[model samples]
Target: MFPNQIGDFKHIINTELLKSGIYIVKIQNNTKTYSDKLIVIK
Candidate 1:
């Protein structure tokens, strides 16, 4: 249900729902490191 590219993953993160105001996240990659969070306010 998600793309394999980092950019696409970022897009999903920005658009996906988190109505409870908290999310448990994980990222799997060896070549890059992501150390930030994307918050969507609706």
Candidate 2:
């Protein structure tokens, strides 16, 4: 696992560890859900 700094409340994905590609990101909580596509270029 990589290191992350704590903020209000969120996911801090370290892009430096990801290669050039397209990925899907999704997150859901008690009353909400979120989704998005992430593009990483190196």
- Which candidate number has the best lDDT? 1
lDDT of 2 at 13: 57
lDDT, candidate 1, 1-42, per-residue tens: 545467434322433445555433445456666545555444
lDDT (10s digit) by residue, model 2, range 1-42: 533433322344545446444333344445665545464554
TM-score of each: 0.27, 0.29
Query: Model-by-model lDDT, in order?
Result: 0.47, 0.45
Clashes of each: 0, 0
Per-residue error at 18 for model 2, in Å?
Answer: 8.1
TM-score of 2: 0.29
Candidate 2 Cα outliers beyond 4 Å, as residue runs: 1-20
